[model samples]
Target: MSIAKRLASQTAIYGVSSIVGRVLNTLLVPLYTSRFVAAEYGIVTGLFAYVSFLNVLFTYGMETTYFRFANRPGTDRPELYNRVMTLLLLTSALFTAGLALLARPLMSLLALPPGHERYAVWIAFILGLDAVAAIPFARLRLENKARRFAVIRFANILMNVGLNLFFIVFCPDILSGKYLAGLRPLVEQLYDPSIGVGYVFLSNLAASAFTLVLLAPELLAVRFRLNLEPLRPLLRYAYPIMLMGLAGMVNETLDRILLPRWLPEGFYPGRSNLAAVGIYGACYKISILMNLVIQAFRYAAEPFFFAQSNEKNSPHTFALVLKWFTLCCAMLFVGVSINVELVARVFLQRPEYLEGLSVVPVLLLAQLFLGVYWNLSVWFKLTDKAYYGAYIGVAGAVLTIVLNFLLIPIIGYMGSALATLACYFMMAAICWWLGDRHFPVPYPVARLLIWLLVAVGVVAVSWWAPIGEGWGRYGFHALLTLGFVGLVAAVEGRRLKAL
Candidate 1:
């Protein structure tokens, strides 16, 4: 199959799971937003922001490390897999055990209500489970088991959604003296009506474990025997990546982490930061279209790029891949920008949460820069100059810290969005500029810029043209999308056809 077609197939399968999962999860945004006040959702948001950072800790950059060494010539695939799996198991166990030990103190530090300590424990467990499962998922990607990958991914999301509905939607009525008035005594004995957002975390913990059950084949494939001798080089390779991952995550999530500290009076007093976080997060989900695409491309491209290391004109091939990724991502940016009002409403069921709408475009562009940074980063990885990646990340992290510290206090959530955008753009530009000197790839920079300009023009026009009310906005967006499609065809139609 042609590369674009292969990528398209993988993207479709990946998108089926990712896009659908994001949509299903997005459904819960409205449920949570409508049911819980902004403060409650903010706490949910804040904790999960921490969860995103913790995931990087639990995985410890092994995902990319495994891909790097696994694709290196003359490496024994099974041995490499075993080594990485064993390492991950150790870390996962250690992390869970530590969390189990320190859950109370950490909960206190997060300023959880006294009765809400269990929420921290449940989140810790969910993350640990996900960490343990990371290797198996990465293995699926490396082996090109896209179908199995999609199935497991989609199934996990469905399980989470089902559990969430049972806990948040069905359980309250089922347990209360309303629907089951006859069994009120029995139901009251089993269900605690005041659990509130804590149940969300518990439901997630249960669903995470359930997701692991479906990975029985991968779990059973784990061998007792693990080689430590082959791990030295992998560790050397992964150390900088871990730093990069950690710093990168801090850049993305630290604003959420430190926002409470920066605010003299919290965004909403007497409420958990999770609620404000929820508003930010729910709106943030609207931008996941680009993130999901970037994630899918990374799944396919990383291993593929490493394997093609010795191929003729390999750098050129990488450049081409980067070009296409940029093109498609630019298209997504325009698509989302035009339809954002429709998309924003999906998660903002409460009119109050709609206050965060202005930050949506800012966050979307930030995520777009993040995807571009990811594509630009392949240069450092292929050349084994990963320390450069670390430098770039630290630069971004410094920006993240300085901006969030300064502006989040002044402008609130909008500051976080702006910080993220600035960080990612700086990282992408530095990586691209520095990478060209070491391992030059003739990316069609001019063509790529043209596409971006066209996307900007489309968004500008869409912003100004009302096209009237109700469904008219969607009609306007449709016309805007067609205009983009035609422009891409006119400018690069033959290039796409050649693929």
Candidate 2:
């Protein structure tokens, strides 16, 4: 099979776990938006942003390090695995304990409600569970255990969504005598309305712990040992990776972290900073269609890139990945942006959340640019020039931080969205410029940019010439989307089929 086809098939399997499972979990947006006030949901959004940053710290890029060394000549795979797992176990414990011990202070720092320190403790455990699971999950990808990975990951999402429903949706309803009133007495023992939005944290904690339990077979299979001889080289490689990861996350999540801090009071008239965050977070979900694609592609690409590193055609293969990835994202951007209103109304639940829909297309395109950067970054990863990746990431993060600080005060969340778009675009451009100098790839950049420009033009037309509402408006949008698709096929069909 062609390299692209093999990777595409693997992506399809992983997509079931990522794309399908995340879509299921994302479907809970309506439930959360309905049950909690915007400010309450903002707490969820903000804390989870920190969770992203903390997760990168806790794992510290060790999973990729494990992949790098485990496949080396003359290496003992089990011993290497044991060392990585032992280190992860020890550090994860310390990190979780530290957070639990300082939950109250951390809660205060986060600006969470007094007495909501339990949220910090819950997040700590969730972070630890996720950190500990990193190596085993990466090993599954390396070993081509995609189906097992998919099943376990899918089950985790199911458990999370189910618990969310039981707590947030069903329990509240029963207690309110909305339905199943007879079960109110039973639920009172299990549910506490006073906890309120705290159930979201508890549900996630349970799901994360449940996932660890499910991975017990993988964990148990590792021979117990604490060998540290392999530790030096691994850390040497991983430090840059950790730096890159942390910076990449800054580009992705710093907006969430800073929006509330920098957004001026009374900026949105009736809206508080937290309310604006809640609205932005909810609107961000509209971009998940693109995020889902990037995620599945990453899960598949990382391993594939490593395995194909020795092939003579590796650079060309990487270029194809970028071209196709950009094409898919461009098509997605136009299709979704033109029909964003219908999409927003379906998932957002509340009219208040709909106000931030303007950011959706920008965020979607930003994610696309980030994915392009991911593809361009293969040169650094393959050449063992990982520090260069860190440099690029730090550059992007600095731009992200600067842009958010400058923009949020002036234009609200829209500034945050624009910052994200500009940050990723700059990162991609820098990576490509460096890649061309250090390790050139024959990416069809001109054709790729043309596709994106065409997509934006079509979306603009939809905005300028609305065909009213109802089936007519939607039909017009659908036709526009299909026309974009046909244009892509006409231009790229022969090359695509060759792949």
Q: Which candidate number has the best TM-score?
A: 2
lDDT of 2 by residue, 1-499 (tens): 8777899999999999999999998898988898878898898898888889999989998988898887677989878888889899999999999988988887665577788988888999999999999999998998999999999999999999999999988998898889988898999999988888888889988998888898998899877677667598888889999999999999988898899889999999899889999999989888988999899889998999988888898888888888888998899999899999888777888888888988998899898999999999888887878899899999999999999989999999999999999999999999999999999999888888888888989988997794797999999999999999999999899988888
Residue range 139-179, candidate 1, lDDT tens digits: 88889888898888888888878877876777777765457
What RMSD does each model have against the real structure? 2.6, 1.3
- How far does residue 183 in candidate 1 sit from its true spot (Å)? 7.4
Pairs in steric clash, model 2: none
Q: What is the lDDT of candidate 1?
A: 0.79
- Tell me, by lDDT, which candidate is best: 2
Cα lDDT, all candidates? 0.79, 0.89
TM-score versus the correct structure, for each prediction: 0.92, 0.98
* Candidate 2 deviant stretches above 4 angstroms: none
Candidate 2 TM-score versus the reference? 0.98
